[model samples]
Target: MKQDQKPSVVLITGGSSGIGKSIGTFLAAKGFTVYGTSRNPSKFENFEPFPLLQLDVADTYSIEAAVAIIEKQHGRLDILINNAGAGIMGAVEEVPNDEILKNFTTNYFGPIEVTKAVLPLMRKQKQGLIINITSIAGYMGLPYRGIYSASKAALEITTEAWRMELKPFNIEMTNVAPGDFATNIAAGRYHAPVRKGSPYATSYQNILSLIDNHVDDGNDPQEMAKAVYKIIQTKKPKIHYKVGQFMQKFSIVLKRILPDKVYERLLMNHYKIK
Candidate 1:
């Protein structure tokens, strides 16, 4: 590489911490010019090897402004990682409309808008990679976290369509469906307001405990970051890359081979939902 040649520029949303932060720092250390986004940059104290830009994926203005900042400084973006997302926990029927909307806005719409904002630049370059950080939940809707699961599933489908649609322009797109990973997600996960006498109240609590435990015992964020680094280096990445524990990664495969009832039963048993 020529010394005068600039490093590839990468923009990862919701990157102040957890998976996003790890990915940003890892790629930066590998010589890419990485920028991670947070809702409030002032709140982030550490982002070694990269810088933080203020961005709220839910807001169009914030998304546009952040992209502009990158364009001004970097001139072109080589990669866009849509890792910013939020979750809402509740039974599908019990979750409020607002809560479901909130989940979709952050986990689905946010990434869609971010991709739209970055596409023009990518198209002009005639080459770029868009990696949407979805989840294993996207493949199968969990008991209480239906909204989150649905939102990710939606993003995954959009990415599939984008991959084909953008092929002419040489824009590559894929979904990284990670199973549970040890991160600050558990600390920030949102739950629905459960009424004392509501039938779902007790069940919700029990199920949440199980999910929390699973997350606590999940894979390392840095491990996931390393996976993303490899995906970036590859000449042509797959449509979907599932990363997690052996069973979690295999779950996606089982879902394909087993009958619907069989898969759901397995999922319910694993989550202790029944």
Candidate 2:
């Protein structure tokens, strides 16, 4: 963690695809000892792969075991990227309560659980960076993305508390807030609130149509990975890094500048949702 010494052991969660995979590919190419985790790494094929550790961030036991393996092999961890998350889309009222809780557990609590397991070592070493892959949802509200927004919003709060607490120990917390990224999020999402007789059923179809368009315009994961690497090497990494289209930055700025009603209307108008 010293200015002259660099930490080479990097461990990333959800490194099988999208942003996580891109970060792994980029960092490994830069000579970092990359240890990426996948719930099902077998899905990766024909690609230059990083040394993988089996971890499902949603499972604390899996996270612990992966960290143990990393510690035993590498002796120290220089970076921790909390990139494991799921896209759960639906209105809060329509989504099954259990599904909402489960999504929150995976998207919000999972990162904290993994971080808790790794922090003792990071603090003891007094020099490590923790990067969280949050979304623009953390800053702006959107229709039908209630669960996803709430989850990232929770992390945004956690990051703030953690930033102050960890900085004193020479560890830093950086949140990556990306906008529409070219990923299979919408395509890969699992909906637990699909009920034909449910009142929100018709609205759900409309939401899905909107999401299809959003996914069509997402950013490349590699671009996000490169940004993360820069954050790692930079001397002063901020508390948050925003990626994606200019709208991503514009949204954040508007959130800061606009009144509550104005922002809410803008959000509704942006998605053409009531």
Q: Would you list the C-alpha lDDT of every candidate in the order shown?
A: 0.88, 0.83
Compared with the true structure, what per-residue lDDT tens digits does model 1 show for residues 184-273?
898888887777988888878888888889888988999889999888888888999988999888888898999999989987787666
lDDT of candidate 2 over 254-274, digit per residue (tens): 889989999999877766667
Which candidate leads in lDDT?
A: 1
RMSD of each: 2.0, 2.0
State in Å the error of residue 206, model 1: 1.1
The residue pairs found clashing in candidate 1 are none
Name the top TM-score candidate.
1
Give each model's clash number.
Answer: 0, 4
lDDT of 2 at 244: 86
